[model samples]
Target chain A: MTTQTKQRRKQALLHRTGSYGKGLLFMLPWLIGFCAFVVIPIGWSIFMSFNKVKIVPGGFKYEWLGLQNFRDAFLKDNNFPVDLITYFQEMLLMVPIIVIFALMISLMLNQRFPGRFIYRALFFLPVIFATGQVLSELFVQGAGEVPFIQQYNLETIVDQYVGPELAKTVMNVLEKVILILWYSGVQILIFIAGFQTISPTIYEAVRIDGASPWDSFWKITLPASIPFISLNVLYTIIDLFTFPQNPILKYIKENMIKVDTGYGYASAMAWIYFGFIFILIAVVLWLFERTMRTRRGRS
Target chain B: MLLSRLRRITFFDFALVLGFTALAAFMSLPIIFILNHAFKPTNELFLFPPRFFVQNPTFSNFEQLFLHATNATVPFSRYVFNSVVVVTMTLVSVIVVSTMAAYVLAKYRFHFKQIILSMITLSLMFAPETVGIPRYLIISGIHLNNTYLGHVLPALASPIAVFMLVGFISQIPNELLEAAKIDGASHVGIFARIVLPLSVPAIATISIFTFQGVWGDVETSTLFMQDETMRTLAFYVNSLLSGLQNSVAAQNVAAAAGLLMFIPNLIIFLLFQRKVLETMIHSGIK
Candidate 1:
């Protein structure tokens, strides 16, 4: 290469690096936070999961006992494994229900009906209230659940028809209806937002072709909303897994504060639970991609 | 699609509205229940069948809450003050940091841009429970425990906010930035003059979400703020529920406290509902 060309290329590279430096400077706060709060803590937790943690005078002391904590969580202890399985089972049923409910409500609310603002406000109100400790207290006080079951005698009727285990599951699902509805607030908002972005011209064209509303929904609306559906599915799974009411999370919290159970075991349980979440998200993403590809092929 | 047909209100529309209104009523029932309990006299709180409406609404519960607040070792107003201070500080910082980072990610061509953006997105899926213990250790290690910085710093770098802002900023036409650049505007000058003002709707939307998220947070406040005086309203309300149980007055007080914690966010939501919904729709498109 000529000397002039080489010099120009070097200057371009320098300019690129300088701009990259500026971008990094803009991102400095998030970098520091991600390192201190997210990366460091995750690394520490992984390290802690393999050891025994003890509270010392100035700080914590760790003694390495590699794989023992994981073993205890998987094989030695029963509660963590059982809780993890139950959580997965519950999420398998709950995630789809929450997503579908949100979608349906958002569709309904998307219509330009009278009192739309009121309905929207009512639906999104829960996002403000039904979070963290307040939700637990509300459920405990029977403000959200117990009264409905008692008012209709749902427990007795369901128990009479099903076996005890199935009946218990049925009752639990029934009890969770309110909580599930509460969880749909953000998803509903997202779906409604997605619905708004669907251009009216497409619907107009579909109508000119003599398609009915249902036909238009399947052909136009659903196809356009596939991205949002996947987003909502992933979001629902994460929300369910991290919910304050999840038994596995409650178990982890209990262990963290208890002297006997200790932090190492709790961290191990957290990692295992997180693994289940990762798998669930991966499965959902895989399913979503397959559906998208088939739709593309068909179209 | 049906929304475009304003002249025609069909049977399906009526049914849809009716059904959704019923659902909305059911959703709002808990809030209504809390409001009722907040005003009910102590004697009527535990009545059989749990009355949905108060027989005789009174201010005694609220009065008692104020009385307790005034007499407590750490005054109740102190919690409110702490919440306002922390939320305001966190809100301003989060908006500035997330906006700056998001602007660069959206507009600039830089090395590792993809990697940094993906990292932020991935961290969104990391459950707070998994990070709680280690985060606590870090906070204590840095001697930030019991300080507002402990509460504000960790929360200022929310990945979700960054994601949403990046999506919004990406929509701003490149031609606009190019024009500004040609006029001798530096990066900061363009960001401050063109980007910040143009991104008001997105900023407002994120600010509302951030405010509500930080305001409603209790676990972090409880973890970091060992001193009662430094706790937020959420911590105060949670403590009220857990510390005092079974007493009718306490239940009423707890209900009142929940209302106290809810009012600010409620007003904010009412004020910014349109902007929030619009920005959310815009972000969802991306």
Candidate 2:
């Protein structure tokens, strides 16, 4: 009876704490890892952004530079701002295309079919070889281009409308559509995993209620997958922004290594780049959350 | 009615099959080139017009690759071994750490939870390489430089993995977790017996990411370590390219190495694809 009373007091104490302690306990390892790896470095990066860093005997020597580095990135640097804008525009087009394609292919691949696994494997193989140098090599060898694109003389017609300069950019992206497919592998895997969470019984029940495949897709399949879609959108943006061939990254390193700009300027450029991405991601997440809330309210 | 409808082949299905076939054929082009190019002798690699298929396939490229590997200061297999150990260790740590944290973030309400969540989102904003100098310093400061810990430690804090797992783990019903609580299970028990098993698909997805990142890793090999023996196979392959830049023979040998390297990635994907299916049968419970 005394032991039972002791257990009851313990349970009451636990109820008061609301398992916050347990949550922290579970998150402990990652918390330590995060503080060690992420927090310190990010703090350093922020500090570095405002200071001139010189390589000394054992470590870097910092000389404070107020906002000069930031000013240089915005006012003095030509390529940094232009490359950042171009990357943003490219991602705005590419992210939606990749996500939608991932959804479609994953939906199909989720179906029961003969040789589906083989098809899935084939679609994903490019990701393995999509490492930078080899892909560029393949591109130089004309492997990423659709052969019919040139034969069709489509660029001439495109040039008539968008003008030559913009048309050339459009044509280049069109030619790299195969590489876009290569980029969708992770998105596809995420979508498929997400599709697993939706129960078949719900589909069956909806079917019994006389919904067509198309109707069920928009009403049932889509709403369930929105979170995964948002996740993919987030991943896609980050992936494209830091693309190995991204001129912005190259520009940052080039400026960092140069005597004129050095690490201060590069860090400044990086923070500028990060600020844009942070705003874009925050806005997208906010918009998505609003939609999610509306969907929940309707349900 | 649904089963019968499925049995009937519609023109829509036909169109879908055709579309998928076309996409697959298009996707397979580079793979075909890689497969054929790896077999071609040095002369054929640079043939004018660059023949799509090798007229005379040879194993000489593989031979050259192995011979070069053997002649390196540290044998090629040593680099391969280093990569395997690092990749395996990193994958295990990343999955375990990320999933445990994800379970809490997804289900538990705690003080500063919002901060942890935002921290993850923020980490994803900046490129990792931007912090290279500081991260290297931290590694060296911890006295982990030139060791496997340098390769494995930083990667364990994988925000994307945690993000993906939280997304996946959130799909598991709250009532189910509550039910386990009523059954007197500890957090560790619930995590091991329920959360881990239920979230196999997410694990598989993150495993593939971790494997690919560590396997093809350039930064760790180039940045953290001063010793050549501690470097990975990817660094070796990269060194080969730079060492023999502009050589036709190097092209074939690099192609051979590229082909060999990508197989592990492909196999990992295929293996995980099967794991993605394991939870579907049990997860229908809401």
- Scored by DockQ, the top model is 1
Point to the candidate with the largest TM-score.
1
**lDDT per residue as tens, model 2, A1-299:** 99999999999888858688889988999999898888998898889989998888988889999998899887887777777777677677778888998999999988866567777766666665676546654654467777768778988988998897677567767877887899987678778878888999999999999999999999999999998899889878888887766678878876777876777778888888878888988999999999999988988
What TM-score did chain B of candidate 2 earn? Answer: 0.90
Task: Identify the candidate with maximal lDDT.
Answer: 1
What would the per-residue lDDT of candidate 1 be over residues A169-195, giving only the tens digit for each residue?
A: 677777889888899988988888788
TM-score of each: 0.93, 0.83
Could you give the C-alpha RMSD of every candidate to the true structure, in order shown? 3.0, 4.8
Give each model's whole-structure lDDT. Answer: 0.83, 0.81
Note the chain A TM-score of all models in turn: 0.90, 0.81
Pairs clashing in candidate 2?
A: none
